[model samples]
Target chain A: MLDVADVHTYYGEGYVLQGVSLTVEPASIVAVLGRNGVGKTTLIRTVIAFTPARRGRVMFEDRDITRWPSYRIAKAGMGLVPQGRRIFPSLSVRENLEIAQRAAATDIAEPWSLGRVLDLFPALAERLRNGAGTLSGGEQQMLTVARALVGNPRLLLMDEPTEGLSPHIVAEMKKLVVGLRARGMAILLVEQNLAFALDVADRVHVMDKGKIVFGGTPAELDADETIKKTYLGV
Target chain B: MTFWIINTLNGLSLAMILFLLAAGLTLIFGLMHIINMAHGSFYLLGGYIAITAIRLTGGFIFGAIVAVIAIAVIGAIIQRLFLARLYKQEMRQALLTLGLLFIVADIAFFTWGGDPLLVPQPPLLQGAVHFWGIVYPLYRVFLIGCGLVIAFCLWAFLERTTLGAIVRAGMDDEEMVRGLGINVPLVFTGIFALGAALAALGGVLGGPLLGMFPGADFEVVLLAFVVVTVGGLGSIRGAFLGSLLVGLVDNFGNAWFPQLSLFTIFVPMVIVLALKPTGLMGRV
Candidate 1:
């Protein structure tokens, strides 16, 4: 559903994403695994045009969205669960979810609704009137994910969804990712957690030094000890 | 006792006008992060337009409405054509708006002449009302009522509606709001226009009492800055409280200690700032 071709991005003069290319097929989870400072987040940001690819093209549903602004790219069926769960702190939980609710751009049969999202995370339903910043770390992560789901995005870009969470919370997040994939959502998950990535991702791409050094099935990646050790530090 | 009561009423009437202007100023800054120095020009221009409209239409309410609509349209045009390109370039925005203030001031001088104009109160609000063994102008009471009604409406609009929620969220984190597929530029234009409209409404409402003179724009604008600074930059409730305090101080100072009037109005602001660097209710 999404094709990122030869994307090269920069963070002010530093070449962060150098000639990286990847594709996410329909209803499949593509996980990009890498160590710190390896351009995983840069790749996601480039796809959404936050830091637009200076030299490459991004295609979503067969349309070139390379030159589009961040908001336009989001409106064209992409949702981002950004790093640090950047929820609006002063706004209530309900306000956060309400702002993210938009009509789906494409005709996705049985799109996500507020009721369905609240059902997925009942904890959020209870704290509807509470400020988003007051939520616990795990609840904030759930709200972040729920915020993205309310947009009814065809493709979701998640940056380190399991970061800083307890083991039990991480397991729940893995289950949630799998559940989203089951409901026909394409996701590009950037993760440092190898087990969770391998557990949920249909395809895995290993990145190192702004380039994708390896691409294969999770089982193949598990078997390749050299690539895993050298690039991912696993 | 009679002197105290009359001065309190005078303070409230003035405070209501100041609240209207400051509320608009805070909203524009809170949302757009642009210090629009030209905001006061909207007030001045609104008064000029309202005077002409009242003469043309022969009614006070019609003229005020026309003035607000005209100012709102002008605000939208200015935002779309001038301010839109300067987003995130705060220095440039400030300079550009300051230039606008000068240009507008010159235009008003040339068009309306330098003489102070007296705006008679609406016919229905012309007389006096007796309260607490004291007489008060009916027009001043009407101004206070306008302030209260607008305050309630604004509070409800910002709290109860989905668009209001988006605006509140946008004020907190604009990037995240845009990431959620909202057209933030459109929202910015709408807010700028709304703020301009509110400022214009204040001008029309206050012209009868304050008198529309050549330097009235700058005077009111300076007072508004003090109000927002003392109240906190982005809080409406803060603006309301700040306006009342400023109005009361100004009125009582001029009445009892005319020599210390200028300094008295600023004492509360200094005290508030000394205690809380971010003003009364600012987030940061």
Candidate 2:
């Protein structure tokens, strides 16, 4: 479980997340939906302590990790699939996964082994010897997800995993998300894709101008038209 | 034919020393973006320590090992105490390291008494090789071999090992590396220490030929910089190529055009910068 309370984050002089708050229950997907530049990425970065919060607290598994270093935060069960599929271009796909492979937290029932992960993405198995950069967009996205999965995180922070992905790839990613949740891993997903987020998210929070403006179940969000248009623009 | 063989070998031997020194400089710059002005001072101090060790221990191998390990320890200390606090603050890092450069040089002068000393060669590597009427100092050949072995080891480690992948990944994206639960700060210290160790090794190796002199550190440091610049920063291949190019130019220039010896290496560097701007093999 992860709780971000009244978090405030800044990039240099520009305040990105201003008193924003959210919570992700264990084994559930909590989607934060917003249009461009609503601090969605910053929210993710703040929780992971990349662009750390200037105020408030970030609690992970009931432990305060607000001021922890990024690596320490990651090792404490926070794995990130960053916005860009920033795989190490020169490294082989196997190397990319190998560099990130880590033991799962004690709470995790079934950890992701290289063999299991390869089973999840068979396309990657054949291309393990090939360079990551040489992978197609879908394969690269798969590699990015696979790389994070290998870290054995309890809380996976996915920042726009579907961005620039094809429709089928996005759908495949959606399936992957549900499958991961079924395996008992919590995910905090930031998205601009309203339909994709609404379909998979157990709970949804729509953000606008560095603050969460709407919160409720997927059905509740579907019934509310004005909130969707105002924040997510359809 | 004889003239060419001798000069080429001489140039190559000197280039090996330059490669050892500049290789470390470039890797640090690549990963940490730290200018590390104290690098030359580390070299100078290493030579002093090496000659002293050789004199006392009566073993070139022991002297070289001591010099390397000492600098590696000192490098780690500096990284932990100073550089960790000064991350991404390039100006501050430069100023701080520049101060360290002067401090280290002064310390060496006080300890070593500003006297020139030659590193004693091992008995096994003392004689010259005679092949087809070509005479070459065995030590120069040994130096070339040493450089090549180091280069090969570095290449293999970087391209073949998992730790090397983490390092390469760090060089590409630090945030991504840290997000994978890796101890990036620890990697930083290791890399900085490794860089300093290589420079120290260069000092020990170059001592026999260049001799340990007071102002030689600054002089050779400039050549190392030129190699890094001309080869492109942060690339090992670039450093090796750059060293050979600079070495040959300097050696040939001093031999034939002694009047323009100062400008020979710089001329090629300027031309490379003007044409490529990032050096020959630099990524950016």
Per-residue lDDT of model 2, residues B1-284, tens digit only: 99888999899999999998888888888888888888897788788899999999999999999999999999999999998899999999989988998888888888888678888888799999999898789999999999999998987888899988988888888888999999999999998999899989999999899988787778888999999999999888999999999999999989899999879979999999999999998866
Error of 2 at B125 (Å): 2.0
For residues A94-141, could you state the per-residue lDDT of candidate 2 as single tens digits? 999999999986766788989999999999999999999899988999
**Which runs in model 1 stand beyond 4 Å of their true positions?**
none
Write down the DockQ of candidate 1. Answer: 0.79
In model 1, what are the clashing residue pairs, if there are any? Answer: none
The lDDT values for all models are 0.90, 0.91
Lowest summed lDDT across 10 adjacent residues in model 2 chain B is found at B114-123
Clashes of each: 0, 0
Candidate 1 residue lDDT tens string, A1-234: 899999999988999999999999988999999999999999998998878999989999999999988888888889999998999888899999998998875667777889989999999999999999999999999999999999999999999999999999999998898888887899999999999999999999999999999999999999999999998887
Instruction: Name the Cα RMSD for model 1.
Output: 1.6
